[model samples]
Target: MSGVWVWVEQHDGQAASVSWEAVGLARTLADGLGEPVTALVFGMNAAALAQEAIQRGADNALVCEDETLAAFRLEPYASLLSGLAQERQPDVILAGATTRGSDIMGAAAVDLKAGLIAGAVGAELSDGRIVATVPVYSGKLMSKVTIPEGSPQMLTIRNRAFAALEPDAGRSGEVETVAPVLPEDEIMSKVVGFEAAEGEISLTDAAIIVSGGRGVGGPEGFEPLQELCDVLGAALGASRAAVDAGWISYEHQVGQTGKTVSPDLYIACGISGAVQHQAGMRTSKVIVAINKDPEAPIFKLAHYGVVDDLFKVVPALTQAFRERLGK
Candidate 1:
């Protein structure tokens, strides 16, 4: 059956959490479009990872296992996927918006001339057509785009945009072995040794994020923010100003140049929402902004707002939450 084809992402030979989340979203889109879900896994030994995809609601798992595919490089991975997509010709193609993933989507779209959508918040099927919602204007506005006269609509979903589903071992799905049509001689880029970035929490996958901005004053002001995040079990993110001020690292910066986070809860502390910062976090499920200025742009989009000093407010809120939870 022609269906929604999703790429199951794995990093460093292990299945990544974002892949599971993508499966959940694929299930939703497939159901809405009245199509089965077919997943693609490519690696040195992605067979084991393919089995995990079945439990995550895939109707069939396509495996392309080869030793040459051990590491992720541009040429081989892209050629293999582009060939599979051409022959399979599914109605919709969905991939995660990660380092390797984005690269694949851009290349595949070029090869197939298919419509590509990035950072999709949600997708819907209406009048026998697929329409998707993506953030625009640095997350200041949301646009629902429709891909017209396309063979297969390609969409790259951001991480943490949807909740993961429970795995049911009782339910088993089909698995198919695929051979790469493209030969190794045609591949251009070669794989080299890899290094993993060090971090306490990956901002993209954080459920709750506590973000600070220029209003925090300086590096010393982050102490309260950090304490509050620890109390709430949340990740700490920062705006460009805070990072530029040497209050935090660029990795913690939330903006166009940094990571995009759509956490369940995003608490903006002492921040005056700049367009750049909003670009990263406007997709959050619920936004709570705390700043001394009531007119801050963040308050306009925030579901809850507190116009007060973050130093005083953060500690009080933390205490209240701990007390309420009987911690």
Candidate 2:
């Protein structure tokens, strides 16, 4: 592991957007440290993605194509990544702070005894060590974490925190085929199947989101917000209180205990902007809060505050957007 290593997260041969962002970060860090960027890709029939990784900025790629890795099972993925890290001894490892990326990286860190920085909003090489900027105390403050000079420095980058470089289709690099570290029979766990959420945008990848809270009143109260989301082509999200109240599923929860999001625009309806919820979406580029309570905490941090009833306001906004966008 003499080079800067980035684990390119992929699904069904398509790469995650954050994987490319991590590559962009890796390219910058590698340039500063005078190291080559090496991408590690694993999945069934992921050779094309390996090539795409090179086009995105990796100097070379190590690809592992196996049926065992077709679905992300922790046992095989972690075993393969950790074994490779031990053998190659990469100076640094980067991955997206996605479910699979975080899972495998955490396991690899334990196996290799490497220092891992999770949920890093930004990072740079300082004094030959990685200094990662992490949010703490529910986004109220930023904490700087420095990985000491030892073992491989690993980091899971928060989505949208770094810009991905435009791919150069003409660029060429080396691609090395690798094998899985564990045998199928030896692995304890297996991926039975996947039940993906349909017709909904991923919160981490969404550019815009329309979220509801306790203020939405009940499960049916989310209908107006859903309409708004449809008009905006945005993902529907919810505060923990709404989720706890059974108004929405946990998958739609956006808070410290749920999925972290960093969208370009976040419209919070009937949300009180609790610190817990803020931790998940405080990084959104533009925050708009629509609450009847003028003194709602969400108004304090929102770029635009609409003090009104969300039921009334949301429908109006949806209709306006539909008319304007010609939807």
Candidate 3:
């Protein structure tokens, strides 16, 4: 009831950008509610991340850097977070809707018996409670959920839904070190190996994304899209059809069954933009569709449409962008 809290997620000592985005949202909500923002850091380099959290927006930070907390193991991390929330009694808790973020939040919410609003696009203070705006029915409709008072309101924010504040180097805040709630022996799960995709920007964190679908043909079809992605310094994405066709890996799929993305610009090439696909990228700031069929469903939601063969248009666009960018 005293402060607003943000969960700072990190990997290999580097904090995820979405974590800072959550901190930014927490700062705004905290200011409005007249409560301080406290960032919770539970991993390697927690102290440094705690300071960066303050630079981003938090008023203070609570850090726990035990060996067991070094890598993200669910049981220990969630137990620590839940215990802290129960003891401190924060008004609200916010986290990025990444896989790890969502997992930890859901587990902690179960422990605390608190209401959790997942993948919220917008939030505001209403009558001393938090009202979260969430997309429902495959992004076809939006519903608002208001968290009641008494327990800490929890929300997982969608990526790119809100803007992050500029960091101020001079900004300073208190960093409190805390003990891990669970012992290493009591933690059930273990992280055996971590293999991250090399050289590809994560779709969720990409500012711009270029996606391919059924029109792209086979695995070789993704080469053109890769060229465009390289030219634009954007992430490469695919629809479920393309993924199922082996045109691209499942990691690149963007749809209801794939990763949700809200980039500044989303370019759909050879994609029909089915409702399932729209569910993921519908919240993008700008959308462009290119397909031979003018009647493609993707054109319905696109801000700009190109009725031409992707083979002819994609290469032309890539070359134009390369020359324009001098790359």
Tens digit of lDDT per residue, candidate 1, span 1-327?
268888888876677677787888888878887889988999866887787888888888899887667777667777777788788788888888888889888888888888899877777777646688887776768899888776688888878766567887876888899886556677776766666675467788888899999988888888888877777788899999999999888989998777878899999998898888888888788999999998999998899999998888999988988898666
Task: For candidate 2, list the clashing residue pairs, or say none.
Answer: 1-88, 1-89, 1-90
Candidate 1 vs candidate 2: the lDDT winner is 2
* lDDT, candidate 1, at 60: 85
Candidate 3 lDDT by residue in tens digits, 1-327: 689999999999998888988999998899898999999999889999999999999999999999999899889989999999999898889999988899999999999999999999899888778889998876778999887766789999988887788889999999999999898789888898988899899999999999999999988988998999999999999999999987678999898898888899999999998899998898888999999999899998999999999999999999999999999
Expressed as tens digits, the lDDT of each residue in 58-78 for candidate 2 is 999999998889888888999
Candidate 2 has an lDDT of 0.91
TM-score of 1: 0.88
Higher-TM-score candidate among 2 and 3? 3
Lowest lDDT sum, 10 consecutive residues, model 2, at 134-143
| Steric overlap count per candidate | 0, 3, 1
Off by over 4 Å in 1: 181-187, 190-193, 319-327
